[model samples]
Target chain A: MKNILIYLRLGLRNLLLYPMRTGLTVIGLGIGIAALTFLSAMNDGWLQNMKLNFVLTQMGHVQIHAQGFEQSRRISDYMGDTTLVDEALQSMQSMQGGIQAWSHRIRVSGLASAAGANASVLVSGIEPEREKDVSRLHTFMQQGTWLQPGDKRGVVLGDVLADRLSVGLGDKVVLMAASPDGDIASEVFRVRGLIHSGVMDVDNLLALIPLKMAQHWLHLGAGVTDVVIRTNSFAVVDSVVSNLQQRLSGKPLEILRWQEIDPMAEQWTMFAEIYTWVVLLVVIIVVLAEVLNTMLMSMHDRVREFGLMAALGTTQQQLFAMVVYETLVLVFIGGILGFLLGGAVSLYYGEYGLDLSQYATAFSFMYMSSVVYPELTFNGCARILVAAMLGAVLAGLYPAWKASRLNPAQAMREI
Target chain B: MSDHVLLEAGGLCKYYHSGGSDVAALDQVDFQLEKGAFTVLSGRSGSGKTTLLNMVGLLDTPDMGSLHIAGENVLALSLSERANFRLQRIGFVFQAYNLIRVLSARENIAYVLQLRGMKKTERLAIADHWLFEVGLDGLGNRRPDQLSGGQQQRVAVARALASKPALVLADEPTANLDSVHGESLMSLMRDLNDRCGMTFLIASHDPVAMAAAQQCVYMQDGRIVSVATP
Candidate 1:
């Protein structure tokens, strides 16, 4: 170990001799690492935001969607009895460390209009008291208040939709939907609240109403889309789902997690994987190329020197170790610099977040809801460092092997 | 002295295959050197002097040869064993004075000693002693680039001697130095030969080196023409 350290020091000293070249090569590696870290952080942030908006906002930690409801979105997916929901809620409440809150969601599509504007909206009818504890929609409201029990004609308008219709506070809106009899029934609703979630799709199209009122208006009583359960922790979603399935066996009910409910979460995860691989490949190529070029040049310049070492009782193994030591030195110094630069950028963006306010309209589709915050996990950082070192070691191989295989007599005789 | 042959070679031949034809670099040759003898091999370029030195030093394996160094047959040893034998029994000085450019004169001398697994204190003491022996007492801290050609050559000589090996093979050790420094280095090698009983084999084409050796072997083409005892 000590001899290796000595040789490593010698290698480092030799690298320091060419300051400009060393600095440039390190900067190149730094740029590559920066690309990887920055993109990784952005991908993580997007997934987290999606989980917050689409999944956790209403579905809770786990959801028990009746089979085929996720694909078809029809009322036929509702299974068992409505009384079973009460028993399940009671069972969840009585269990120790199992679940925190539970609620049933009913989704309906209708045309909502003011005096001059009409747009299609997705109406979610939820239990007031249970939904508050389950999904925390109370924090999302910007104006008015939540629906009360037994309220038959109350509705909440998303902030963007309310803004487009020039209605707020106590403005009345018309909700028109087709009844089960295939007849269109229209009802005038008093806007009870305004919800301003920065997500453009949700804010422009989603509305929350009382469950009983939704049932009465759509002529489908006791019809729910799915049952969402909130657990104390999200990490145990799969375990809870498994236990729920085992307990509710022989009943055709299928429990779905967030990743199951929203196929986009899985897509986001695959995107993160592809993005990380691309960054790794590009960075490895650039770093390895620079290091290989430098090492080959340095070795070729010291042909006669290597010959002398070979002649002076230094074995081929020791000579190869010397070359490896040199490459490791380059990697160590360059990786440190790259890590510092990349980490500085990541931390800075992670803390302050990147503001896309100017291009907010342009990013409406990609859902730049708020500021873009960079996210970093411990695992991602470790992977970057290990990858950098591995690239460095591999870059040293070709040159070191060549130097070790050279004939001492012929090498010394070369001009 | 007859009972202890420091070096021996029998039927040593090295063939070089270049392009399409085979050129014999060294024909079948037999030679020996007694302990503490200063032996010199002299020839023009491509005359096999350096090839003979390399084969004897175990830097290159010879085809069709039986070689013995300090009573051990070299042909029967493994690669690592041969390396170990070279580390323990041989020291080498080159024409370019191949001291590691990043290291100081003292560190260069102590390098092989460290390879020999000597302790730091002992290596240092021996390194300083040999630096002083080669008339570079306080200059041990200077790198090779910081010194002149003669000083670098002296540092190289000090490094080779610091290991206390049984044989020191020098390939034109004074090739880059002036006549005065060359004569002084030759005298230093001779004095070490007398005091420490370390065998010396030097390969050079210089007239000064031919006159300085106790036995001079002259080569022509790829074979030895004559061996003169002076």
Candidate 2:
């Protein structure tokens, strides 16, 4: 250990002998690591925005439905008794802090006609007072007001659906759908609000109505098709789902997390994670190339010095260790510089957010917000640092080997 | 191999390829140095004085030779073992005053002791004593580039003797200095040799170095032609 410290000291002194070369090499490596850190923050921010938009605007963290309701979507597949589900939810809510909110709804396909124009739509029967607590759908309202409990004939239509029906707030539209009793039921409802969610499917084919009115019109008698649940955080969704499944066991019900409802969002998250790693790999290679080039150049410049050390009783292993120690010092400083540089920039942007309004259309297509807040997580920063050091070691190996293998006499003879 | 003989080499031969043909650098050289003796090997350039020193220093391997230093068959050691042997038993001073430019005068001298696993304070104390012995007492903190050529050479001498090796090999130790510094350096080496009872074999054609030696060996075309008491 003492000898190793001496070698380290020697290596440090040798590096200090060439300040300009050492400083430039450190800065070059710093810039590469900074790029990696910044890219990772951006990717993290993008994925967060995508998940938030998908979960908040429509799918809650978890959902429960009749066994075959998701695949069939038939009104007859509704859960006739929500007694066990309500009991499970009440117990969970009493436990304090996992389930944030929940709401029951009846969802069915329908056709809307107004001003002699018709369009296909999926209508949701919701309790307005409970719906707001479970989803952020009301927050996306573009016009008029959300449905109220006493407003029996009031309905809300997505902007695209309203445009197709040639109707606006206060206009009456006829909604027609087949009841589970084998009857074609129809009703006239006044449009209460217009929702402008960026999701094309949601904007083109959704209508919201009062739960009591839909229950009466469809002759379902107080039954709900599905229950949507919101957890305090996405991380707790799986555990919450498991708890609910256990409580509602043997009751012909299926429990699912948000990812199962919108598979594309889950796949996009996976792709984003994989993309970050690929970018990290590429950046590490760049760092490796830069460090390798600098170390090789430094070694060539100090060939005679290395020869002198070898002649002064330094073993081949010691010489190799000296070179590695030099690289460790260099890369360690660079890694800190990069972490600070990247962290400062990310923190600044995280507070104010990076405005990507010019690419709003592209972002909207992916269900992402126009302004993204760059987040630098601890894990992300640690990953970048570990990878940079690993790259530095790999970069140092060849030059260290070459230096240790030098023939002392021949090297000392170099002018 | 008498007990007083510190180094012995027989039938030492070294060859180099020049113009696609082998040229003899050291041809059938036979040499011996007694403990505590100061010797000089003198020759013109390319007469293989430095080549012989390199062989003795273990910096180069002779094509054919049997060498023993302090009764150990040095030629039979492995690469790593040879390195350890050099560390513990041999010291070298080069013509270029090859002091590590980054280290202080004291550090250069203490580096060998450090490699031998000596504690910092102990090695540094020995370094200071050697510096004082070589007339560089207060200049221990100065780097080689910060010191004059003569001062740097003094520091190199201090470094070589600080290890108290079994044999000290110097190749052209005074070639880079003028007559004044050269004479002073030779006087210092002779004084150190007499005071410490250390064996030294210096390769130099300098008249001052030749004059200061207790015995001189003259070489021609890689062969020792004469051995004389100066």
Candidate 3:
């Protein structure tokens, strides 16, 4: 241990002999690590935004539907009795950190016509007060107000759908759908609001109406197509789904978490995670190249010095260790500098958010917000630093080996 | 090998290839050094005095030789074993005053002791004593580049002796210095030889070094031609 410390001290002194070279190499590695850290934070922010937008705008953390209702979407497949679902939800509400909010929804495909123009739509029958607690759909109102309870003849249309129908707030539109009794039922509803959700499907095809009115029109007495539940966090969604499954066992209902509801979202998240690592790997390779270049140059410059050390009784292993220690010192300094620079920048951006408003249209299409808040966790910082050090060790090895292989007598004769 | 004989070499032969032909650098040389003796190998350039020093210092191996230092057959040791042997029993002073430029005068001397597993305080104290003994009492903190050429050589000599090795090999120790520094350095080596009984085999053709030697061996064409008491 004492001998190792002496070698380390010698290594440090040797590095100090070439300040310019050492400083530039350190800065090069620092920049690479900083880029890795910053990009990782940005990727984290983007993925978080995508996930939040997915759950808040439409899909809640967990959902329950009648067996086969999701695939069939037929009015006849609606849950005829709400007793089991209500009992399960009431039991869940009493559990610690359980469901935050839940709402029953009746969704059906229909056609709307106004001013002699018609467009296809997915009409959602919702209880306005309960839905506001479960989803952010009410916050997307662009004109007029969201649906209110007891507004039996009122309806809300997506902005694009209203445009297709040539209707606006206060205009009457006729909704037509096949009832569970095999009759084509139709009704006239005044447009109460227009929603601009930035999602193509939502903006082009959604129609919201009071649940009581939809139940009467569709002849589904006390029946709902699906129930959406919002939990405090996504982390609890799977456990909540499992609990609901157990509570509603053998009741002809399918309980699913959000990922099961939209597998594409989960896949996208996984791809983002993998992409971040690939980018970090590329950065590490770049850092490894820089470290290799610097150490080789140092070795070339100090050939005679290495020869002298060898002649002075330094072992081959000690020579190799000396070079490694020098490289490690440089890497340690660079890693800390990079962490500070990247962490500070990420913290600043995280607090204020990075404004990507120019790409708002593209971001909205991908179900993300324009303003993204970067997050730098302890684990993220640690992973990047460890990668940099590992790269340094790998880079240092070849040069250290070369130095250790020096022929002392021949090397001493070098001019 | 005898108890008084610190180094012995028989039939030492070294060859170098140049232009596809081998030239003998050390051809069938026989040598011995007694304990506490100050000896000099005097020769012209390319007469293989430096080559002999390199062999004795364990920096290079002879093509054919039975070499023993302090009763150990050094030529038979592995690369690692040779290094350990050198560290424990041999020391060297080069003509170029090849002190580690990054280390202080004291550090250069203490480095060997540190390699021997001595504690910092103990090694540094020994370094200071060697510095004083080498006439560098107040210059222990100066780096080689900060010191004069002669002072740097003094530091190198101190470094070689600080480990108290059984044999010290010097290659043209006076080649890079002027007469004044050369005489002073030779005088210091002789004084240390008498005072501490440290065995030294210095390779040099310098007159001052030859004058200070207790015994001198003359080499020509890689063979020792004569041995005389100076």
Candidate 4:
């Protein structure tokens, strides 16, 4: 350890003498690390944001929709076994380490009118009491109160939709839609509450209604779209879905998870992996070139010095070990500095996401929400640091070998 | 003592390939130096004096010969073993100082001891002792470039002998020094030889080197012409 440290000090001293070279190398490496961190954070944030509709806020781990229902939007396309719903919920409760909460939802698209203005909206009819246990909509209510058993023909409007229609809490709205038989039916509902979801589409075009009222109005009594199941961890989603599928195999039910519901989320996950690999490859190349260049030049300039060491009885292995040790030291220091710098930038951005609101209107982009926040994990930074250090040591190998291979006699004659 | 023969070479020959022709640098030669002897290999340019010194120092291998330093045959050993033998048994001083410009005088001398795996305290103590021996005791902290020619040479000598190797191989030690420093260095070597019983084999064509040696072996055309006992 002492011997290695001695050599490492020597290598560091040599590098330090040329501040510009070392600084440029560090900047190159730091940029690589920053790119990786930023890209990864963006990918992670995008996936997490998308899953807000299905994973964290809506679909717990698994969702069971009526078979063939996703293929067609018509009410007659429903193929769910309500008899199995009770059995499945019972079995899930009885099984060891099974589902945490389970509930059902009904979705319909129709026109809603308030005061003389009308607009199309996507309405979700949920069992408010049971739905609160599965999703956080009850708390998401921005004003007034969520559905109660006594409040019949009542609905909630998204804040943006209310704004577009110039309405507020405790207002009356009329909903128009066709029943399963193609007969037009219109119902007037009291806008009991308003919700703000932060998502533009959801806030502008979404409404929540009672499930019983939906089934009755749609003329599909005792029927629901699907049962949504929430588990303790997302990891158990696949196994739970498979287990539920096998348990209820004979029925015409299809189990779906967040990954299946939104493949864009899966693509976002892969983006993180690809981003990390690309950044790591870049970082490795940069640090490798840096250490290699420094060691090569140092060896070339100090040919006589190496020859002197060789003549003094320092073995080839010793010389090589010394060079490698020096590289490792430099790598360790550089990696740490780079990590700290990258971490500082990540933390700053994570706290205050990069606001591109100035270009928001110019770019014709609205999908991205306010500011882009980066997510950082300690484990990832540590892994990159270790990899950087290893790259430094590996980079020093060829030059160290070349230096140790020098012919002592000829080197001495050059003096 | 047979075990203390310090350096031994037999049937050593060195050939270099240049321009599609074989040039004999050192013909077959048999030589040995016992402990405490100051021996010089004196020759004109291209007379294989440096080649012979290199072979004895284990810096180069002879084409067809056996070399034994400190009782072990060098030809039979591996590359790493040869290197270790050289580090443990040989000290090398060159005409050009060869001190690492980045390191101070003390560090340069102590570096060899470090390579020999000595602790810093012991190595520094030895470095100080050798610096004092070379009459540059307080100048240990100065870099090579900061020192004059004689001071740098003294530091190089101190570095070479700091580890107290079994033999010292010097290649034209005075070639870069003026007569005053050259004489002072020779006198230092002579004093070290008599007082500490150190063995030295100097490879030089300089008259000063030839005259200062206790024994001289003259070489011509890669062959030894005569051995003179002073």
The candidate that achieves the highest TM-score relative to the unseen native structure: 2
Instruction: Write one digit per residue (lDDT tens) for candidate 2, span B170-201.
Output: 88888889999999999999999998898999
* DockQ-based CAPRI category assigned to the predicted complex of candidate 2: medium
* Residues A17-118 of candidate 1: C-alpha lDDT, one tens digit per residue: 787877787777777777777776776776666565565566577777667777877644654355665576577568764687788777767788898888
Clashing pairs in 2: none
Instruction: DockQ for every model, please.
Output: 0.52, 0.67, 0.69, 0.56
lDDT of residue A137 for candidate 3: 92
| Colliding pairs, model 3 | none
Task: Select the stronger candidate by DockQ from 2 and 4.
Answer: 2
Q: What lDDT does candidate 1 reach at residue A313?
A: 62
Worst 10 residues of 1 chain A by lDDT: A361-370
For candidate 1, the iRMS in Å is 1.7
Compose the digit string of candidate 3's lDDT tens values, residues A1-415.
4477877778788878999988898788788777788888888888887888888887888888899887787988898888888777877887764789899999999999998999999999998999999988999999999998779989989999999999999999999998887788899999999998877767899999999999999999999998988998988888888888877888888887877777778887898889878866866796688889989988888888888888988899999989988888878888887888888899999999999988877766667788889889887787787778778788889999999999889888877
lDDT of 4 by residue, A112-141 (tens): 888888888877778888888787667668
* Interface RMSD of every predicted model, in angstroms: 1.7, 1.2, 1.2, 1.7
Provide the lowest-lDDT 10-residue window in model 2 chain A: A1-10
Q: Rank the candidates by DockQ, best first.
A: 3, 2, 4, 1
| Per-candidate alpha-carbon RMSD to the true structure | 3.4, 2.6, 2.7, 5.0
Best by DockQ: 3
Better of 1 and 3 by TM-score: 3
Chain A alone, model 2, TM-score? 0.92
Poorest 10 consecutive residues by lDDT, candidate 3 chain A: A1-10
